[model samples]
Target: MGSCIICGTDVEGDGRICRSHQEDVVFDFRGNSPDQLVANRFYRGVVDGYADFGVFVDLAPGVTGLLHRSELDVRLESLEWEPGDDVFVQVTGVRDNGNIDLAWSIRQADREFRGELVHDGDSEWLPTDQADETEATDTAVETEPVEATSETEQTETAPTETEPTETADEPEPTETASEPETTETASEPETESAVEAAAEPADSVTASDERVTVASLGDRVDETVRLEGEVVSVRQTGGPTIFELRDETGVVDAAAFVEPGVRAYPDVVVGDAIRLDGEVERRRGDLQVETEALAVLAGDDADAVETRLAEALTAEARPEGLQPLAGDEAVAGLGEGLLDAAEAIRRAVLESRPIVVRHPATADGYVAGAALERAVLPLIDDAHEQSDAAYHYFTRRPTDEPVYGMDAATNDATRMLQDRDRHDEKLPLFVLVGIGSTTESADGLDLLSVYDVEAVVVDAAVADAETRAQVDTLVSPTLESVDADLSTGALVSSLASAVNDAVRSDLVHLPAVSYWAETPDRYVTLARDAGYDRERIAELREAVALEAYYQSYQDKRELIDDLLFDDGGDLAAHVSAQFREKLETERETASANLVTESVDGVEFAVLDTDAYTHRYDFPPTPLLLDDLHRHHANGDAAATVGIGTDELYVRSTGDLSVRSVASRTAEIAPEADVSTAGRREGKISFLAGERDAVEDAVVAAIADAF
Candidate 1:
């Protein structure tokens, strides 16, 4: 029996937590076999890898479990767990074949649990002070008797080894005779030479004016090298102060130590140009400079280093040309804007600045963001020596709304500011894909602009002058002479290729996957040539759309990659099947409930969404309306409207501004307070009390507008 770590109640079967407190205390499994796992007990584990069906977690070395997707509280793709991420899960069962099944725990962090214990095979152990005390006591007991016995033996053996009468006298006489000669011959001259050898190198290195680039450090390991560069980042670790130094060719970490956990060169900070003298040595298979002497470079020296870095970064960042994939004329017409956006992104990567991508939570937006991600990630890996550089340098954040609103802006601002203060990271460049080209995103853009953060908008939306003026770089075909119908995915796929042309083959099929209907002939050919058939393309699109709907605000990077690029195609097929089943059911329900009316010469199909459909489920209001409109319109001028308890959506076959309709409806039903409030697909909100009145007025308003 053992006492509970939290409540001090006695536990059974050598467990540290009582049955009542098991749920409150998280256990750290130390056992090597699955049989030691207790069902319904939460244990800390590391994410090993992901499978199509589940995530594999390693609770201990050789003890792994499957956390199936069905057991997850959220969608499998929505989980942000990467390989080696620490996660908490409950052991559901240990099968006869040595397979362990696990379930998700809502309490993921260490602080959320009341207490923690280490569970060994037969017993549970306290984690900290009590465990340490037990270990110390056992070590002391085993060593104390041996230490005393050895001391006693030494004392008894000393006299026997030396006969004091003869040996002690003989040794003293010889020592007196040879001491003077030995000291004269061996002590003074050698001491002075050794002292000079050490002092000379220290003085020479401190005063040396020679400088070497960061790229050349690998060749000069174990040798003193002087580096002149700007400090890009600074981190004070428990042992040494690490400064990321960047020169013309590359970046390297230089560690300066005053003492253990002490800050060295406290006055030096990020962006300060300095001359560092250190010995290049390998730590954990990476080259690091053990800083010996550091001094801030001044005047001409600092300016020269800064200038070299700037020129090198600029030259490396700018692409030579913007070649359209498949020679599409529309993409070529917007080449200048795409070129500028690409240059900014590449420059940010080279400067060690982070890139934050903000896109809508939709299939088209995801494809656009994923395309840029597929291109930029490889460039990041090639540019930085750090293994985890991709995580730090790039991030994709999906917004719940179609525009970059204040909520997303605030979250971004708070996160960036915290990173800057805590980790000394550079401010990230904001890349807005499929989301930032409208007036709705202006306030978010303005918030970012106040900090002088650069924002690049790559969208197919028609940008007004205000939206164009707010962003640093805008890539929109509508701004140019090209009037071709381009999906945001198609537009961004070209921009992604410009960012990194080496990944051109990977982006070939992305444009087709983004289009819901009317895919361009060239893109279809491009995708087919890339080995993705029409059926395969549809499966990929449906898979992404379903995943995007469930966790609309999360960037499901790994899962999306599998669906879009994996050759197995099983995951896509499975997910697409779910998409079809759910969509068909909703379509059937919506069609049966829909009511058609003729206002003047216009036709309208309206559904009472609140009463007839699953309002909170998949195929959201906007998506459902789009499908309904397409089926009813049949290439004719018709509109589908979904009227909910408080909100409504409008989808049309011809030109109509929901904004203009909302204005007219406000005049007809002044008490309803009608206003546009949702996605790019038109949505309006009104008081619940005036549902009938608002519906009648909106019908009249639509008839007048049509």
Candidate 2:
């Protein structure tokens, strides 16, 4: 037991601070697990990296927490903290799955706190002032006995011939504290000569007698073995150069150290087939090879390794059979496209290439992206042993627009180039869901194709020929039949199941939640079988819709997971209430301002969105128009149009093409500069000055089509 550093109150067992005074002192967490964290207590952490929605902070070598942007006072990009920079935060909560939630702290510096303590999972916390002294004393006591014993052995008998080679592993006494000083007195001259002898023949011809594959390296730990593979990636860290080597079996990181921060084997670059002799060791629970020597292979040796890798990757990348989640005939017809996409995704995982998922910030888009996220994350975890490998391998980014615009393409290209140049990472495989199925996304796809980046698009929109040609793979129902009213979420959710089959059970209920009403009978039965009732499904959909609106540009990965996959009934109910309240308020306002008109025997309901609705808040113009059309446009020939300052959304009970409407309106009102904004959502944009003319022309065009 110890007394609180701030108030002098008695603390509980093995604790340093009382509950009341815990906030008064800043803690330096040296523990390696999230269970050691005390909620609502401040601790010092180092910035690990950045994501779209948050920043990751490391409380210890093995413990990391996410500080979401919602918990920050300013924008995430405005923060100047770089990797390895120290910051302070509060542990908000720890999840059941060991994910830690963090909040920003105003007290960033240690001097701001009244007291400082180090929590190393010891019986009692140690004061910061005494931590260094205790560590030094323990180190001295541990080293002196070993040096004394080794000195006595040196005096009592002459060292054997084999001792020098054994001591050669310890380079020098002053290099690192882990290297003992006993080697200096035991075999100084002999050890130096042995090290020089080992360096001279690093490139000598070594046979494949004891060469081991990466998959079989687990049993070879602590034993020196030769490995032949191509260097896929090379990263320079503060202590060593980590070369990611990939053979026919798997990929493994081989670390070579040449002093601190210096590159080892600088001549060896990526894509070079090489043979290395290293001892396999587990570092932080991940297998890492400590390279004793590495040499790039040439001629037949390099060619043979490359051929082996290509054949193995081809065989492993392709899936057995493209199985549809349900017996939906329309979805089954898209097996060929779906199979190609799934193969590309699986191949990216095998090659250690990152996957970037781009989707719109709508409920349907979120469901689709989250479904794919659920499937791909586990495969990444199983492939790489690094704790943060999932974050590095897969990313889901939300776009505000339905089309893959140039702005998004530019952002992705910039980030990918920076990662490749700085960290030697491979260019990512882009998977666009519920978007990029039309000609509007061609420019963006072209920009990425300039660098040979592969893209796979999964959507239910009537895809265009140019866009289909641009992407590497496209999965859509238009190619089979247009009679099916399939939602984008339903289509991509099925695609996600094809990407990974282990999560098939978890994804059975997702297609039902993607629909607002009139869900297909097959999906309804699937949801019921998965134990999700009608009320629960509605609540999940409403919750995702509301949350998707708040941060339309951010992925909101964990929160979305809580709403969809995790048993978060209370959270879903709470957010759904806000969704209803906001939508009801917007509906009342838009309904009162609506005007009914008839055009050539066709009924039309029009609402001036600029005058009646909130422009930048909840219940956006698109969602509002959807609800209004369902209420007012009950007749087959009736249509609802919500006209904003420069845009209008059309919702009808019959077939309508927003692009055709825009084209006809452009001819009728040539001065308006009309253009289609969204194809499937029935959206058009026009010059704000000619809003009235554009509205009248669009109504007339719809009447002619009707």
The parts of candidate 2 lying over 4 Å away from their true place are: 1-209, 634-637
**Poorest 10 consecutive residues by lDDT, candidate 1:** 151-160
In model 2, the Cα lDDT at residue 413 comes to 98
What's the residue-level lDDT of 499 in candidate 1? 93
Score residue 169 of candidate 1 by CA lDDT: 23
Q: What is the lDDT of every predicted structure here?
A: 0.77, 0.78
- Count clashes in each candidate, considering only residues at least 3 apart in sequence or on different chains: 0, 0
Model 1 error, position 424 (Å): 1.2
Model 1, runs deviating above 4 Å = 1-210, 216-224, 281-287, 479-484, 632-637
Residue 486 miss distance in model 2 (angstroms)? 1.3
TM-score to true structure, per model: 0.74, 0.75
Instruction: Work out how many backbone clashes candidate 2 has.
Output: 0
**Ten-residue stretch with the least lDDT total in model 2:** 150-159
